[model samples]
Target: MPKRLIAGNWKMNGLKAAVSEAETVAKSLSEQSADCDVLICPPATLIAVFEEKLTGTAVQYGGQDCHTNESGAHTGDISAEMLADLGCAFGIVGHSERRTDHGETNDEVKAKAYALTRANVLPIICIGETQSERESGNTLKVLTEQVENSVPTDLDGTKMVVAYEPVWAIGTGLVPELSDIEEAHNHIRATLTNMGIANADEIRLLYGGSVKPGNAGEILTVSNVNGALVGGASLKAADFLGIIRA
Candidate 1:
């Protein structure tokens, strides 16, 4: 069975107060996490603290993004190997914010995924369309290309997870309708099947953007949505645990 995972991407958010929230979230879902994998991908600076506070707890911690290189004078770059060294079991790549703001190219994202795969870390590769693309009724077209371009050709489904986070919805507190989400996820699943992965069904496909506890149960119950890649709500432990519990 595919694991029900609620992975929080506390993107570019958090600070000293985040520790208390992280602790509370770990405590809140410690018991129920056995039913699902709960991960918090805090900024690089907070991974160690989250790991320390979540020790022996159900919540695992990771990083938002990592460089393909292991190490060197890549000023302000954290590598997958380093994230793993910090006890991160997962790494997120190709998030829209990175693609837009930092100008990360598809090849760069693919290289990053390969680097994570080599480092024994699972890469959560993100793929989605923009508001313009969706409005143009080319959602699937965009998705197929993004999936083809962003994912490493060498990666099997188990080597990474994928998030369908429409750029239009991220942080806007808006989500695609359940039908839209299901359609997108199903398309992604089919793409994986064509790749010849044995446990294609078990490879996780997460929905991101405006996911909250109040709406998690229904979303989690969707046919091919094995989990969520949460945003703003991820900042607070209570809010995050609510989604896990939901």
Candidate 2:
């Protein structure tokens, strides 16, 4: 398997003082080498701050989201280029929150991913089935459609990360069974391969939604589950590190 990538999506949390937590995480992990890669995507307000804290450490930082346009009058939107300029190594696109709040579509997400690629930033594309869809036995179908439509057609697998966050499970302290997670990830991998994405098998697949230290180990061990897109647990260094070490 490829080296796992454990990334924390700090979402809209974390202030200036929160930089200390990131520093602690970097310090602790820098002391010991591991087989997986580590990253924290704080709120855009803290990206530059984390850039300083995470420097010279194994832990990297990314953006929560970016615009499809390079630079424009999209008031209140950050572009991939701006994020790259701020020293971001990766950018997240198509997160459920953005999809719901901004009514972002798959085509828009694909455009943003392509824009990030052009700016030398890897895009962690988020896709998941809603609670209703999952309850209706359409989880795989939803995921397939999202992956097919959201992922850029000319994507470079080396610059891509796919995170599967079951919409129902996020922040609700619930997770699908291990077997269910395995099936979802396996289906995602198969769908990517069928889509002709280069090195589809090499792409890192992450599981998200209420992943805590207690169950992180089991979740990470599931088939094709390379890492996690942590939420609340990531705010604390100890909790995030526990998951990373899991």
Candidate 3:
């Protein structure tokens, strides 16, 4: 099996003061041994700052999002090349919030993924079904289409990560049952393999949505669940550490 990855998505939160949390996490992990890859994707503003603070530590930082164009007249947009210049090893694309707020389509997500790959930064692709889709019993169908459309055809699976976050459960303090999570992740894995991604078996599948320390271990143990795309709990050092320790 591939090494598990625990990534914290700080979303629109955190400032310079939050660097202490990264320091704290690194300090804690250094005191013990963690057999997983740790990543923290704060807002774009903190990526460079954390990059410096987290140097030589087990913890790494990434950007919450990146633009498809290497450079352009598009203002307020950060490109993958810029992230690479900042020493970012990973970049998140097609997150649920981006899909909903920015009206991002799967094609756009795929383009962003391609841009990230070209920059040699791993893309953590996010796909999920909304509450209505799940209620209508179309979770698998939605996930399959999203995976097909969002993931590039020539993706290097070994350098990619897929996160399944049920839209209804994100920040709602609700999570699917273990069986449900297992089914979604397994379906994602099978879909990626069917799409002919290189090193498909080495792809890491992550489960996101209301993942707290209380449930981190159970979620991580589910088949095909390589780790977590943590949200709220990841903002604090102690809370993030609790989930990491799990």
Best lDDT goes to which candidate?
3
Residue 119 deviation, candidate 1, in Å?
1.1
Q: Which scores greater on TM-score, model 1 or model 2?
A: 2
On the 0 to 100 scale, the lDDT of residue 236 in model 3 is 96
List model 3 lDDT by residue over 157-194, tens digit each: 88788899999999999999999999998899999999
**Distance from true position, residue 192, model 2, in Å?**
0.3
C-alpha lDDT of candidate 3 relative to the true structure: 0.93
Best by TM-score: 3
Model 3 regions more than 4 Å off? none
Structure candidate 2, residue pairs in collision: none
* Residue 41, candidate 2: C-alpha displacement in angstroms: 0.6
Error of 2 at 39 (Å): 0.6
Q: Which runs of model 1 end up more than 4 angstroms from their true locations?
A: 31-34
TM-score each candidate: 0.95, 0.98, 0.98
lDDT of 2: 0.91
Count steric clashes of candidate 3. 0
Colliding pairs, model 1: none
